[model samples]
Target: MTIPKDKMLEMLHFLMLSRRFEEALTDLCRIEGKIPGMMILCTGQEAVGVGMVAALRPEDVIITNHRSHAHLLTKGADPKVLMAEIYGKRTGCNKGKSGTLHLALPEIGAPCTSTVVGAGPPIAVGRAFAQQYRNEPGITVCFVGDGATGEGSFHEALNLASLWRLPVIFVCENNRYAGAQRQEEHTRIENIADRAAGYRMPGVVVDGNDAMSVYTTALDARARAAAGEGPTLIECKTYRWRGHGESDPQLYQPKEEIAAWRALCPVARMRDAVRARGLISAEDLKAMEARVETLVQEAIRFAEESPYPEPHEALEDVYA
Candidate 1:
């Protein structure tokens, strides 16, 4: 599918935004010592977030994993509130209860961000089933990691989605490593999408680092699900520059491999691709980056200035 030039540029913007937001957040956690709780950033996996989110309709549901700031941001969450949530302030989306782990925006149909390995798939299946029952127009997109494939919930979710022909798009962000263990060491299969065959669902593997490729694949999957087709497993082979969390040591990762992936930076690649297409000039790219930088800084300042929730309001929005 030919994407509009403006939309392509917008995707590039979100890609830049996701990267810069995490960079700022990382600085806040490591250097400034302001952020609370364990922070996980999707620095190298911006393409999967921006591309897929761009492909979906606004009404569609999304369930994200632990590293989900990119997903929420690209899905149109307010940066100030999201950053404030990380800061555990009252102005946050979840009123600062979720922190960096389980960020959810139910008003936008992103009702869940499960940190449990492979938990997103099951929740996505349930949402898809509800959509199927009500004959909704959109599909559920579940973002999981390569590590999530090891969990039994992932298989069960796939099986149910297939059996009932639910409108769910299972996207596995295979970032080469599950925590510290390599994909080969933890799982026997070379590609995570191959597991879709067991449940009779279509599995499409694409370059997770390419925004256009991911968008195209996701667009097709969404179309299929909307047409009453079964779920599709889209394995996005990406790589994360940082460790699992803020406290992880990089002793297990090889310096050479990390350097090689860094060379194929998704944001840089998307910028170059758009530039080659004459969609954006270097000057415009710089201007866009400046705007994003300003936005991120403003978000951080807003979060820092925001107040934490009152002690008496702990159970205000809590559900059983």
Candidate 2:
């Protein structure tokens, strides 16, 4: 798949933006301690989010996990509003209620996010089922971790999706760890995508650090789903650069493993790939970095300047 130079640059920009945004969030958490909820950084997993979302249409839906900042940004959610939501400000995407873990922006087709490990798949299944029923063309993409594969809901959702030929893409961003426990500790299977065979669906595994690879894989899955071919399980083999949450000590992972994955930084890989093809210049890459820095700073300012939600407003969006 030959991607245009302009599009490749755009993908690189999104990946860089996601990384910078998370870096800014980390700094904010360290300095001001203003972030209202747990901070889960997607520093190294930017490629999967940017590549997968880039393959989808504007109307396509995506359901995400706790580590969802990249997913939201890639789906075209406003960075300022998302930052405000993380800061628990009134002008946030969820009116300061959802926080970092649960970001919901219906206007952009990302209706909700879940902090629960395996909860997102079932919701994606429900949304895809609705699309099938209404004869809607849009498909649902569910982002899950390796841990999710162990849950009953994951199996149940896949069974239903396959049975009904629902237009859903089951994306397992297998980042090696489910919190502190490594994937090998809990599951016997070598690859999460292997489980997809049980549901009678096509299963594929790709180098998650490679953005173009991920994009092509997602594009293929999207085409199949749009053609009424049902759900596909795509397992992206990647690694997380940070601990599970802001407060985690991260004793489980060895320093060497972390260093090795960092060496394969997705952003750096994409930049090198583009530069090697003479698609982008070093000056252009530096300029893009500067722009991303400015954008992140602006989002931080917006979040800080926004007001907190009023006490009475908490009950406003609730339902029985």
Candidate 3:
């Protein structure tokens, strides 16, 4: 499907934004020793996040996995505050309580970020049920990695969601590996989307590296859910350039394979499409890049300058 020129440009803008955001965050963790914890960067998965969120309404609920810093940006998270949150500053979205892996922009309808292996689908279905029961307006989007489907909870969640015909969308970022374990080793199925047949839902496999392709596929899924046709499982076949997390050396993954995926880089693909279409001038693209760089630098500066939460406020937002 051909997206409007304006929307295409917008998608390109966000792809750039997400890429720069993660690249900057990586620098903070690696070169600067600023962020603590196992920070996972979705360096090559930018298209999936941007495309999914582009198809979704702002009111739509988003549940994501650990590789979520860039996903948060697609939902309109303020880069400055998000950077501050990663820094565990007082001005964070969660007020320095939930760091990199568990940031939530509830007001933007992205309520939770789950790092557990297969925990997101259940919550997504629950949120979908709540919206349906309340006659609410939006759908729930459950974002999971390819490894998540190996868990029993993932299957159970899909079964229940299909049975109830809940308005939920299950997006699997099948990045060829489940945390360094190649797809060939664990799951025998050729395509993860084929598994949806067992759950009695429509499963789709899309080019995760193609921003427009993903946007169109997710757009169709969004329409189906809105029509009360039950959940749709979308498997995004992409690859991550980095290891599963910061600490992993990723020796299991073949360097040649990583290089191949990098050549098909989603960010570069989107930029090239923009240039080919002449939607934006070459100078415009450069200016956009400069703007994104400035935005990320400002975010880092803001986070560095902000103070951490006071010692007494540890339990401020905690239920326990």
Q: Write the per-residue lDDT of candidate 3 for residues 1-320, one digit (tens) a residue.
A: 67999888888888999998888777778855588677888999889999898888987999988988667788888899899999989998889988988998898888999899899999999999998898877999999998999999999999999999999999999888887789989899989999899999999999999989999998899999989999999999999888998778999989899999999999999999988988999899999999989989999899999998899999676685
The TM-score measured for candidate 3 stands at: 0.97
lDDT, each prediction: 0.91, 0.92, 0.90
Q: lDDT at 140 for candidate 2?
A: 94
Q: Which stretches of candidate 1 lie over 4 Å from their true place?
A: 318-320
lDDT of 1 by residue, 1-320 (tens): 68899889989999999999999988889855588889898989899999999899998999998889888888998888899999999999999788889898998878999998988999999999999999989789999999999999999999999999999999999899899899999999998999999999999999999999999999999999999988999999899899998789878889898899999999999998999899988888889999999989999999988988999889787688
lDDT of 1 at 173: 92
Better of 2 and 3 by lDDT: 2
- In model 2, where is the ten-residue run with the lowest total lDDT? 29-38
Error of 2 at 60 (Å): 0.4
